[model samples]
Target: MILLAAHGSPDRRAQALARGLRKGLERVLGVEVLLGFIEHQSPTLLESTLELGRRGGGVVRKRLL
Candidate 1:
């Protein structure tokens, strides 16, 4: 699983950019890329990580942007 960790933003434009990035990554990887924000968004970093961990053992690479 790929975990995209970001600082996040309250601005609409920035959020849009994040969405685009997630989509592009998912397309390239052919796997779901989950989004987790360090701040200013639902499903914080810890929450997302834990949820993914529950899916069983695997390497989760975090890409920050």
Candidate 2:
């Protein structure tokens, strides 16, 4: 599983771009990709972390942007 963590921006375009980039990465990597925002967005890092733990009860490798 891959978590695509981004800093939330007030500009919606930037957030949309992040989503699109995350989707592209998923397609290219062919892996589970989860998106989370550092702030100003839903499903923050802590939420994502808990969800990931529930899905897989072990270590989760993370990549941040």
Compose the digit string of candidate 2's lDDT tens values, residues 17-62: 7789779987998887777788888678778877877788433444
Instruction: Please give the lDDT score at residue 12 for candidate 1.
Output: 73
Each prediction's TM-score versus the true structure: 0.81, 0.81
Model 1, 25: alpha-carbon shift in Å?
0.4
Pick out the ten consecutive residues of candidate 1 with the lowest summed lDDT.
56-65
The number of clashing residue pairs in each candidate reads 0, 0
Write one digit per residue (lDDT tens) for candidate 1, span 1-65.
Answer: 67788787888777778779989989998988777888888578888788778876344666555
Model 1 sits at a Cα RMSD from the real structure of 1.7
Cα lDDT computed for each candidate against the true fold: 0.77, 0.75
Query: How displaced is residue 24 in candidate 1, in Å?
Result: 0.8
Q: Which ten residues in a row have the lowest lDDT in candidate 2?
A: 56-65
